[model samples]
Target: MIKSKKLMYQIIAVISLGLAIFGVITPGFPATEFVLLCAWSSAKGSPKIHHFLHANRFTGPVLNDWRNGKVISLNNKIFSSISMLLCVCFLFYSGLNIYFIGFGLFGISISFIWVWSRPSHV
Candidate 1:
């Protein structure tokens, strides 16, 4: 059971990592969240995979900063906030149901607030 569970986790980690990598080149997809999810699943499934991600040149520092300090860089904060705002704007203008628009706005507002509340990594 343990082995099977580990395998499942490894699979999830790989899939999330792939999506995160794809997000790097695809606009409107957030890579950081996927990368964090990958890290978490890898840690549960395979220490080797976790170490690789944690030691990777591009991802290592980000993971370390988030893990150690719960810090988000100013640039990231700005980008996230802008993205959320844009999404809210698009939803509002897309002729969606009023309830859906309201929910989207509420969620985006909450996310924006949370992102700004984090310590800036500088």
Candidate 2:
């Protein structure tokens, strides 16, 4: 990779990885998608980071499942669904504008559908 391109990939890897870690703790935030992004970028920019992700006990299985066939386990699907539901409930009760709530509901609905559509196994 060109120097600039490599640097760009490294930046993406670092940012996405950080978000992934954050998502692990934050309800309604996404981890798998960010981890996938980090892994893909790191593969091109920093093999060491890529290796570390694969070797990680928590992240490794998610990455492996994704690589196999974009599988999202049943437990994870259930967890995500509950998280989204809670987020939507919070939004409605938080007294946000109706338009903003509608927009959030729309986005959450789409995300819910996509996550459920993924296979549970290869």
- How many clashes show up in model 1? 0
Candidate 2, residues 1-122: lDDT per residue as tens digits? 59999999999999999999998788777777899999999999999899999999988998899999999988889988988888898998999999999999999899899999999988
Error of 1 at 2 (Å): 0.5
Candidate 2 TM-score versus the reference: 0.93
- Per-residue CA lDDT of candidate 1, range 1-122, in tens? 99999999999999999998887775445677788889999999989889999989988987887998888778777777666766776887799999988887777677677778889873
Q: Could you tell me which 10 consecutive residues in candidate 2 have the lowest summed lDDT?
A: 24-33
In TM-score terms, candidate 1 sits at 0.79
User: Which residue pairs clash in candidate 2?
Assistant: none
Candidate 1 residue runs with Cα over 4 Å from true position: 18-29
